[model samples]
Target: MDQTTLTRPEAETTTAAKPVILTGDRTTGPLHIGHYAGSLKNRLALQDTHTQFLLLADTQALTDNAHDIGKVRRNVLEVACDYLAVGIDPAKTTICLQSHLPALAELSMLYLNFVTVARLERNPTIKDEIRARGFGRDIPAGFLCYPAAQAADITAFKATVVPVGEDQAPLIEQCNEIARRVNAAAGREVLPEAQALIPEAGRLPGIDGRAKMSKSGGNAIPLSASEDEISRAVRAMFTDPEHLRVEQPGRVEGNVVFAYLDAFDAAKEDVAELKDHYRRGGLGDTVLKRRLEDILQALLAPIRARRAEVASDPAQVHRIISEGTQAAREVTEATKREVMDALGLFRL
Candidate 1:
């Protein structure tokens, strides 16, 4: 037998495999340009290269919306529509509702025992969130324990790659800690390790130039926004303050219109020219904003049309989510079984 040419009975695993990627959006409302620059757009492209799972974090949403579940329920489809509108192909990406997966809830419960109240309190992500929500003094227990829930979302799918921004970096660290502690306690590496895939996303600002663009902040351009709406939002966008006059030298340094261009504008020369034109004076804020308007429309037109087409049959959009959730749970349940057995969670 020629060693080089020999073909054994058992074939070697030579096929290329894409690692699991878990990323999600809370069902607060429809995703927007921030979601595009921050996550959704990347998910659509990543689906081509990796096995991606896009979660509708309804369960996580409830951590804060426990008192107002109606908002969460209503926005579940809104979030799904946002995903579909952003070109997250359901065929290429798994779009799942988090609440539909019992394994996540079970895994969260088990992981909860591993994390301490002090540890949860020390979670920078949770702490900052608590402060932001004015829950510092009256924090809900569920809201505080969400890192455990997030860890469940991650490990339930055995996702190895999580796309996160800088602010959420601590959450990933917390997930890794859970994996480490659980593995040590169980004496087995049942849960897969996860890491962040920080893409070169120029952090997009809100219409008001607030540091972050968030739906809750009410400064977002929803992915499903109409062309007219997009135009209105863009026209209302904040630009250089000192650039009061058309001939005034605009400070492109902090101008959000230019920042949007920097994030969404694909043409390097065009963006550079626009930046120089604004910075050197003689360019009106209206002119720069209109340029951004046209540029944004070019990108969002197709998405808006597609969103309209899908919005007509919201039921179909939701069915896709339900189907993906079921398929995802088939895998999540298998992982949960292994995790449960590792933790000695037996039914006797």
Candidate 2:
């Protein structure tokens, strides 16, 4: 596979046309600030200019949460609520349910043939996740094959752009490889290759200073968290332990508080000054935590209120999802037909 196909050319910009963007969250839990800094903020910005589809990926969630089906089922609404709460307008972005789109599943099954098991195992994202989850040889087949499933999701919509974290860029590469293989076999370009759009902030670390902030890790501050919850999470944030005394110099390089501030605090100059002060001594963790707490409280207040308002009517949320899923079904089914025709499948 040519590596050049993985990204759009510099000459082709979004200004040329409204590109299709496919992005979503697994129905694992409520979204957090990590999600916001990583992708949600980009989604909010892209919805107006691009044809964006926000998938409530309940099916993908099952790859890891299969043991607790209830958790995956319930968080579908929770994730959708978070999307709307964060200002993803249902009018601009098509917010669809993954399970409801049978075409995506069919496409996934078809795409698996175009990719090799060895290649799947070699995927950097998959390798890292398997290690993190300690799946060992007991790795679930579905979990191992998620890159193909993700490829199906991306190509089913003919998406040109996919917003993902820096760590997940390999998945996009795998997706394009599958697309190229399928197109090669069909003797034409059946699926459009996609480019991964990595956010500037990259991945946000957990409050405990772990590499990634995740709900299961109990280190993520959910967007819907109450003011008290936000305050407590900030207070417990991991910082330089050696800086026990206010007069001791602190290291900001690996401090989770500084990481969050970098991701959230709009005032870059002030944060830089604070970092310098901490490094030179005289800055305390308490003061830093207080600053982060204030920023988070202000940021989440409106999101929490909007989430409460939208969640108050379950039927309304369901209707919004159903409508978007119906729309997605039409789009994905058409692509499935195109792919089938490209492969000369019988049209009985």
Shift of residue 60 alpha carbon in model 1, Å:
0.7
Candidate 2 residue-wise lDDT, 66-103, digit = tens:
99999999998899889888988776778889999999
Segments in model 2 whose C-alpha atoms lie over 4 Å from true places: 1-17
Model-by-model lDDT, in order? 0.80, 0.88
TM-score to native of every candidate shown: 0.90, 0.94
TM-score of 2: 0.94
Write model 1 residue lDDT over 15-82, tens digit each, in one string: 12778889998898888887788766667778778878888898898888888898889898888877
Candidate 2's displacement at residue 237, Å, is 0.5
Lowest lDDT sum, 10 consecutive residues, model 2, at: 1-10
Sequence-dependent TM-score of model 1: 0.90
